[model samples]
Target: MSGAAVDAASGAPRRGEPRPKAAATNQQLRQQAVDRMIEAAIALIAVKGAAGLTLVDVGRAAGYSHTLPNYYFKSKNELLRQAYGRSVGAFRRRSGAWRRQALRAPVRDDALFSTMLAYVHGGCADPAGARAVNLIAAEAVTSLPGLLPEVRLQNERMLALLQDRIEAGACGTGAAEAPASIEALLVLAALRGLVSQHLLGVPAADVDAAVRMLHGFIEGGPAGGRSAA
Candidate 1:
C-alpha cells in the first residue's frame, strides 16, 4: 500500500531512495520535514481527535523521535495552527487561480461546473491536506479557544470568495440557489463531509462515489440520491 502522504511528483512515493520526510532536506526541500510533520499531525488529529493529540505522538507518527516536533513547534497548539494555516493558504491559492481562469472563460455551465469539479477533485486528490482542514475545522466548531483568530478570519474570507464567485457566475443565469452565501456554505459543507468520510476509514469506492455525487449535483446531473432511512 502507498503511504498516506503523496509523493512530490507522482503524488505517490517512488520505489527509489527513502523519503527524507523530516526537516533535513537540502536547499530545495528545506521545509520538507516540516511539511511531513504537518501531514502526520493532521492525520493523527483526524483519527484521534484534537484533545487526544500530543507533540510526542505527532513526532513519532512523522517518523522521528518525539522531540523532533518540539524542536520546530513550541507546542501542539502551535503545530495545529500552522498546519491549518498552510492547508487554508493552499486552498486559497488554488481557488484564486481557478477564479482567474473563470474570469477568462464564460460563466456558462461548461466553465462553472468544470471549475467546481476540478476544485472538489483537487481536495479529494490531496487527502492529507483535506483531512487536516476538516479536522481543524471540526476542532474549531467544538473548541476554538486554542485556534488562532487569523484562522477564523481566513475562513470568513474563503467563504466570501466562494459566495462572490458563485454570484458572479450565476448572474442572470438563474442557476444558483437563493442566498448565494447559503449555497456556498452548502458546497463547503459537502466538502467537509467528503473529508470526514475519508478520515473515518470509509471505503475508497464509497468515497469516490460521494465525490461523483457532488460533481453530478454541481453539473446539473442526477444527484445519485439514496434513501437515508
Candidate 2:
C-alpha cells in the first residue's frame, strides 16, 4: 500500500497509463450478439434464399448456439423483417448521398445517374446486396404481391429523384422532348431489367456495357448518341 497499491495479485495502474475499463454491460453484450445475428441472417439470405431459413441456421452462421437467435428473435419471419429493414436503410443512405450531390451540382441529371450507378454497381461489387435483392425479388413473386410496401415506397422515391434529375437535365436538349417522369420511369424499368439479367448469371461486362448504353441514351436521344457532360 505504500509505493503503489500492490497486493498478492496484480499491482495498481502506472502514471500516464490508460486504466482498464469495466467489462461490457449485459445490454452491450446482448446488443453485440443481436448485431451478429442480424449480420449472419443477411449473409445467409444472400447465399441462400430465405425460403427455409431458421434461427438455428442463423445462430450457427453467427457462431452462436441456435437458442441465441431464438432468444433475440422469435421466428424466421421476424429475422427476415429485421434484415430487410437494415438493407432498406442502407439503400436510403446511399440514395440520400446522391440526392445531396445532385442538389449541390449545377446539373442534376448527372448526379441522378451517379446515384443510380452507385446503387447498380453496389450490387456488382458486393454480392451480398445482389443476393438480398434476388431474395427480395423471389419473395415478391413466390410468396406475396404487395408484401414489400416500404421497399416499394422507397424505390418510388428513388424513381422520383431520378425523374426530377432527368427532367432538369433535359432543358434545351432533344432528350428533354420526352416527358421527364415517363423517361425516368422507363430508365428505372431498364435498370431493373438489367438487375434481373445480372442475377440470372449474365456476364457482368455485358451488364456494365448495357448500363453504359443506358447512360448514353440518357445523355443522347434517338437522333444521335453523345456522352453526357
Candidate 3:
C-alpha cells in the first residue's frame, strides 16, 4: 500500500500500472464505430441511393470525422457492399425461424410456401431494412454496376432456396412434381415484385391481398386455372 497498490496475493504491481484494458476497450470502441458507420451507410443508401454514397458522407452521418469511414473501410464500394450485406443479414435473421421450419419439412410445398410468406411479411416487419435493400437493388440495376453482381448473386441464392425446396418435395414418392427451376423462378419473381411494391408505399391492405392471391396461385397447379390440355 506504500509504493503502489498491492496485487493482494501477488504483492506489489511491477510497473505500478493499474491494468490495461486498452485492447478490449479499443476493440469495443472499434466495433461501435463500425456499427455506427454501417448503420449510417444503410440509412444513406435508403435515401440517397447506393450510386450517391461516399465514405466521407457516411462518416459524417455517423457523427464522426469525415475521414473516419475511410480509415475503417478501404473504399466507398467496400462500405456499400458491407452495408448491403448487413441489411441482407438482418433480413435473414428476422426470417431464420421460417427458414428452419421449412427445412424441417422440406418435402412439403405448403411449408415452403409458408416460409416464403414469412419472408415477405418479415420485410414489412422491418421497413427500413427492406427499403434499404430495395434502394440498393434498384440502384444496382440502373447505376451502381459494381453492385450488380451482388444483386444478381442474391437473386440466384433466392432462386436456389426455392428450387431446393420444390425439388425436395418433387423427389418424394407419389409427389406431384413440377419443373423446380421454373416454379421457383415464378414464385420468387412474384414475391419480389410484391415486396418491391410494399417498399414503394403500396397500401398494406393491397399488398396483403396480393400476397394471398399469389399464395392461392402457388397452391394451385402450375396452370393455376383454366383447362390444362
lDDT of 2 by residue, 1-229 (tens): 6445553236556767777798999999998998889888888888877775788999999999978888888876677777877776675566566556656767534655666665565555556765775586569657734446645765688689788877766744446667777878888888767766777788877776676667667766743333532
Candidates in descending lDDT order: 3, 2, 1
Number of clashing pairs per prediction, in order: 3, 0, 0
Candidate 2 lDDT trough over 10 residues, lowest sum = 220-229
For residue 84, give model 3's deviation from the true position in Å: 0.6
How big is the positional error of residue 186 in model 3, measured in Å on the Cα after superposition?
1.8
lDDT by residue (35-128, candidate 3, tens digit) is 9999999988877778878888999999999999999997887887888889988888877765566567744446555657667877876777
Error of 2 at 176 (Å): 3.9
Give per-model CA RMSD. Answer: 12.6, 4.3, 5.6
* Residue-by-residue lDDT tens digits, candidate 1, 1-229: 3354445546556668676566644754537778888888878875677667899998899888799898889887888888788877776567557656666776444444444444555565566777667667767767766784756787687577667766666643233435778766776677667656655677756765665555445434243222110
lDDT of each: 0.66, 0.70, 0.75
Say which candidate scores most in lDDT.
3
Model 1, C-alpha of 75: deviation from truth (Å): 1.8
lDDT of model 2 at position 226: 39
